[model samples]
Target: MVGDAHRAPETAAGRLGRRLLTGWAVLGFVYLFIPIAVIVGYSFNDPAGKFNIIWRRFTFDNWAHAFERGPLTEAMVRSLQIAGIAAIAATVLGGLVALALARYRFRGGALIEILLVLPLTTPEIVLGASLLSLFIDLDQQRGFWTIVIAHVLFCTSFVALTIKARIRGFDWTLEDAAMDLGAPPWRTFSRVTLPLIMPGILAAALLSFALSIDDFIITFFNAGTTETFPLRIFGASRNEISPQINVLATVVLLASVALLLAGVAARARVEGRPVVVLTDTDG
Candidate 1:
């Protein structure tokens, strides 16, 4: 009876702690998502003026005419084109770099690694300015190609690092095993190695795409006459803040969310078996 009495207070304290932690978690989520909530909520808002900040009423008019603005739609399409091209280029180049670094121990490996990190560590302003100067020196026009090249330059680092992190301590002997089983090197890589690392590659590609699409400073420096979605929004903010902007942004948010869900589902399906890797780092 006495022991039970003593344990009762400890149980109550534990419950109290759990409740506090749950409250804190709820508050943290609210803090993080409140702005997102506001954006979504305001997408449906019917404002009296050009600015959609102050909500007057709710209407589906915004959704009905979401893509009616030709300039805005064109800018969005431009951004998508850049993002697609940049993401593909970055993913291919970075995937090769990641594969080489993970598999081989060649000369100048340390230097290559350092170079990979430099773009990531450098400030966006500095990189953008450097790119601008390079283009000027080459007498190249600052337009779609320049923006794509600039995005690829910075996004490659992110893609490489993300894939490297994903494949760190990964077992490359699996390749040897497949080769020993009479599989050609290319076939072994395509059939066995590719499947395992595909998730990481997809993740890196998505990251690259997101970065390329959302880039402002670099694109700002490189874009001479071309206007991306972000640039269009900036222009709109100066003149008229349209509800269409919010509508498009919300659409992007939803697409991103859908992609995230699909990736998660694919990962779950692929990860049924445990990934075997070597943890030893000794040479």
Candidate 2:
């Protein structure tokens, strides 16, 4: 009875600690989200030839202007194109690297993994400068293609990491079983392994796309004449903060949020959860 009495206070203390942690976590989330919320809110403000939020009224004219024929729209299209290509290329390369890492044990495997992840750990400015130097040395044009290549360089690491995590948790027995059933290695991989890891691949693709689309510094270094959406935004902020830019920002923000939610929903569905009804309310 004395021991139980002593344990009660300890348990209560643990619960209290957890509650405090939860509260702090909630506050942290709010801190992160509030700024984004404010930005989105301000994106709808009307342009009175001024960038100040206090002097503006709410309007959708900025969004219309952003979408209309302009340099901003052109830059946005260029950005999307570059990002799409980069995401696809990075995902493919990363998938292959993840497969090799997961399935093979060779000499200097650890070294190879480290090398693959080097771009991610290295400072972006250094990497960007190095890429620019290489392009210059090779006498290559610094344009959309260069930006795409730069994006792929870092985005591939994220893809590999995501797919590798998924691959680690996978059952190799399924692959072996497929092989035993007289399926060829390629067939087994395509039918068995690919299906199992599709969710990870999709997640990696989304992550890569987001990274490529949002990248500024590296793209800035590599992009000579070809300007991306973020690059345009940066330039615009220097001259004059246009309401049109806010519209573009809001659109991108909404798209990112929607894509993120969709990815989560897809993952849940793939994992055999009913996304429509998350919990049972019955006692």
The lDDT for every candidate, in the order shown, is 0.89, 0.82
TM-scores for all candidates: the values are: 0.88, 0.86
User: What's the CA RMSD of model 1 in angstroms?
Assistant: 5.8
Summarize candidate 2's per-residue lDDT along 176-267 as a digit string, tens digits: 87778777998777777787788889889988988998899999899998889999888777677776766777788888889888877877
Error of 2 at 136 (Å): 2.2
Clashing pairs in 1: none
Quality of model 2 by C-alpha lDDT: 0.82
lDDT of 1 by residue, 1-283 (tens): 4668556455788989999999999999999999898888999999999899898999999999988959999999999999999999999999999989887879998888899999988999999999999999999999999999999999899998899888888888898987887879887777778877888999999999999999999999999889999988887797788888889999999999998999889788778756632222233
Model 2 residue 124 CA deviation (Å) reads 0.4
- The candidate maximizing lDDT is 1
Q: Which residue pairs clash within candidate 2?
A: none
